[model samples]
Target: MSKLTGTTLAALAVTVLSALPAAAAPEHHGDDGLNWSACQGQVDPRQQCASVTVPLDYNDPDGQQITLAISRIPAAESGLRHGVLLTVPGGPGGSGLNLPSSAAKRLPPSVRDRFDLVGFDPRGAGRSTPVSCGLDHADLAMVNLRPWPAADGSIDGNIATERRIAETCARNGGPVLRSISSANEARDIDRIRQALGERRLSAWATSYGTYPGAVYATMFPRHTDRIVLDSNDDPDPSRVGRGWLAAFDQGAEDRFPDFAKWASAPDNPDRVADTPEQVRPLFLDLAARLDHSPLPWPGANPAELNGNVLRETMLESLYADARFPDLARLMLAGLGRRPLPAPVLPPEQALQNTTAVSVATLCNDVSWPSDPTGYAEDVAADRAAHPLTAGLPVNVMPCAFWPFKPAEPPVRVTDRGPANVLLAQNLRDPATPYRGALKLRAAFGDRARMVTFDSGGHDAYLANGNACGDAAVTDFLVTGRRPAEDVFCPAD
Candidate 1:
């Protein structure tokens, strides 16, 4: 899922009779007394905001209450108004509070004018009754959040780190933390639809949001209209979040070539190597050296650049082709070479919320392999196969040591939904690779037609800059016209 830094880049199991009406009933807003004014400040003047209170635990609707921050930008041209179009932001942790504005900008004017653009911060994120694991600043760093093995592929440090983080969250995170699974998020989305009084919602869900979107369509088929899943993740129920965590290895391998080419281009101002082939080894050696001796990075959260820290930054930078320079500059700086200073990290509160929600959703979505030996072997094998990432993708995370089991099973995505879904993917997305997307596509089966872009980056619609891919998606969102079959958009 795309973090808040922006530019770059970029599940469920249950049916419970919460306050929400049955899936077969036409959606209607009851006397929930939702006040659109509460959503102010986060919404544009053209958009109205509302707070929909949902049960923190769907199984016990009357037990405790949680609010979902929801906003809607009504059709700009009322004469052509069609229906509501929801923009589901990525990130099992990413907040969709600001997505209506961002997505409205990317949409074609015709589509933008016809459909009301909606966005919401999923439970445990942003203004929607946020959850916090109360992790210290140092523990919230991306390097710490994403497990990375030691320089020698030893799992000792990683295992200890996972245990510590897990212990912290388990102690600090309240019952809300246990409710932050993908299945719950999907259920919350359906509840939002009911609150909006919409029989069906046209949606554009990206990254991790794709999983919940798929689940929503499966659980409530008739409620989806013109669904668009961008930068999709694999819907392997058996693996769930573990599968996504492991996919980074393949994703990095798929996307590194793009970075290599950019970094080695002779004419580029930030070129780091003489040729693409040299970029990989140069990066590996630099990371290894940093692993042994980290440099002091004053402004960074952890206040230093270790090998794993650099590796984490590399993974984030690869999300967007435009961010390659950020990684290259960091690498150059660590190599006893002068480069630009690193960007400032978000405020501590922001980081805490983002990190907390990310971990809660990921760890709560599925049970991870608890066997330390399994992680050790996988990390070692991954290190050998994809050295650029240095086995971090397969390394142990807090999920491996999480104290609580998933409250519910993962939703099995199947071909039981309306055939209104269209999936768009980049062939080389560093975050959600094509190989994983194939699983999601297969889960949807005859219900979806995929438009694969032969491009590089995390996002695939307007963000990818592929005219072929963009046109296909835009047409579908606007006119409901889908390709007769799966299609590929060649590199431009």
Candidate 2:
């Protein structure tokens, strides 16, 4: 749900450390260990970790306190230092803590040596005072947590599921849940910029982070430096989070071709069909069969491989090219051509944090239609139009039943910011999809010029490896030069 793809999740995890409480304001124990030491291990050596205290809620700046875990990779050469560059990770749940180092490696030498890359775990995520609904392990599973309806298109099960999830989160999530909106995250980012002693900060924000970044640029226009928003989401304020959830239908449709081609390739070990076109119907048939009769998946949270669960996994796997095989293998297993073991899920702690933050941000961003009838109507219409998604995108979520209303209205992304923003998007992103990116682009208007990549899966920039698209982004980041007009990079 949300932009909580695995890459986004992993990035958020590293940043999660930034949200942790500060060690008793360290004694003047010296610049001995303070000199920008190399970060240890997989956590970027270029990045130096630190903490900054921000209000739990920005509206009440003098209220309760929370600490944000912040990291910085200084400009390589002081003589070339230009300004600070902030890396905003995706997932309202995702963390940006280690992004400074991660993003530093992606920058061209020109940009890397000119700016200190900064990253932080937003409040209610990762290292920042983490929030959990204390949900049971089963409830934390992706399929269940996302509120996918029963196989036969029944809203009854979904409604019940939403109520249970919403109630549990309300009871156990504490006050932190109330403060987990994207608006709050944007305010927190501004606070981090102030803490960094910067007048303006260049930023690279992706997926869900794009919305907050755009909001930040709008809220504090004078404080924004060059900005890059990758894998952008629809910035429709009225339907903010709902638009993202609804977008999965289009996203899955956009990305299925990549999976189809892979599954149909003659050389592939898990080839499931003779042609790309055949792959879709074959998958649909398999899911429908499983819907009526689920296969026992011992040790799995749901205890069975139901149709909706399989579909959900398929959607998740489509986020990256590396995950294609997982979906193919499952397809083979479901076809009884090559039985395989069940997949291992993430640790309980990780799942809880992910679910908690995802739900909180989505529900707190805007009000979801509470009527079961409304969801039923939308699901029916969506099912007919996009069967691959199985009406899941339009179905009810915990937000529909959430007891708490959003404290603030969703921030509308506008053209009121500096014209320093650039957006990079994959044409076939399963999570953020191109159609939605177009909406965000339209919202930003002249404020952003997008570089659309002819590629499949989610995320763009360094992770996607499309040289044309990557070069466009790198050029913008380094030179603060965006294309005078929108550009498209054909698939290589």
Candidate 3:
């Protein structure tokens, strides 16, 4: 949430009202020109908020404008300052205005002394002049956001749901919604650099942010300093988000064993099975039972715990080992061994806003096939092959019914950039599996050095408790150096 006080809001209004004359691409400016203001809901009092105005559409720079909300925690030591180190978070919709606080606490003091930690809310998210499609509360549920086919693998319902979301967004979302894409995000980041009066920037980006971070590195190679991309997405220009979604099938398969092992452990209070092998069958049986008769979950967004809902919970719980209990407890409830847990959800407005941005960025990035027949066949085939995810990865989405074609081709990350790039990955990341991370590493060619941490769940670097992996990345960020070859850290 933005920490904008009334005075800060007025300052933002004044800043936007007195818009700077739209310039050429960000390269044209080296002037410091940010309007710093009051940012609310900040975890670190030292973090300050500011706004940077950029062209709403990069193509027509002189046309209209939009404000991007950014935050920064100044370098702790003035003499050692190297410049801005931008932090990019995941989600085409992930809010980054407070990311400086999140990143600062985890970084080493050596890094803290060298750069001002900077973060921003992308154009269509958080306080960056947010855009919303006013979607129905029911449509905002995770089970619905990613297409989860019917019990028999039919996509008839997916097609309709996707079409309705697309149509509603088209009618209600204005120019801003149509403008969200990775290419534009790259452009926005460049503008922020110019606004900060910095000649170059180092960046630490994770998950979806890595796409734009890579694009920024590719598009403005000379201006990028040190670059760190963690838990990366496959840079498939043609497929984009489609390929990312598909990875969930393989990712789920790779990460489930860890959960199974934990769930059957004698010390675990939430153990759901007597043995690791039995856990899979138990989960599949419980899900199938829920499909036949959904448990009445009173306060949940959808008001029921169906098979799809269980699958959605499983997908989220696989993100980190710490979240393993969420899935275990849900399994216990499904088996009537314990009561159902209360639904934990974000604020309705935040969900609505982020969902709108997510759909827009995805649909506007690339085209999706509109053929319902083809989607149904793919779903049926995927279900038979990967029952854990039940074809949710290959299923259709709102992009199938998107109202506009992509404004420009997706940015193709290449090997031509500087060798300052460092790629980090967890061996068993459920959202971004090793296979996909490899594709991204290969795309960067000799320009990057990869550090693979043999572990489960998503995120690497300061996230998982792998001191070896964290030291390698921290060493690189602090001294502008990387391992001579692709390094691997054996399981801890």
Best by TM-score: 3
Q: Which tens-of-lDDT digit does each residue in 1-492 have in candidate 3?
A: 110000000000011111111111123233366766667984688898989999998879989999999999989997777778899878878899998998888998988998889999998899998999998988887878888888877888888888999998988889999888888888899999888987778899988888888888778776777889998888888788888888889999999999999999999999999899999999998998899899999999789889999998898889899999999999999889999999988898998888888888888888888887888888888899999999998888888899799887776676775678899999998888899889989988888899999999888888888889999998887777778899999877
lDDT digits (tens) for residues 85-118 of candidate 2: 8888888687678888677767778788888888
Clashing pairs in 1: 2-10, 12-410, 12-411, 13-411
Q: Which runs in model 2 stand beyond 4 Å of their true positions?
A: 1-41
Residue-by-residue lDDT tens digits, candidate 1, 423-483: 9999999878899889889988888899999998888989877899999988887777678
Return the clash pairs for model 2, or none.
Answer: 12-95, 15-97, 16-126, 16-127, 18-69, 19-69, 19-127, 19-128, 20-127, 39-45
Provide C-alpha RMSD values for all models, in order.
4.6, 6.9, 7.4
Q: Point out the worst 10-residue segment of candidate 3 by lDDT.
A: 3-12
Worst 10 residues of 1 by lDDT: 4-13
Backbone N/Cα/C clashes per model: 4, 10, 3
TM-score of each: 0.92, 0.91, 0.93
Of candidates 3 and 1, the better by TM-score:
3
Q: Using TM-score as the measure, name the better of candidate 2 and candidate 3.
A: 3
In model 3, where do residues sit more than 4 Å from their true spots? Answer: 1-31
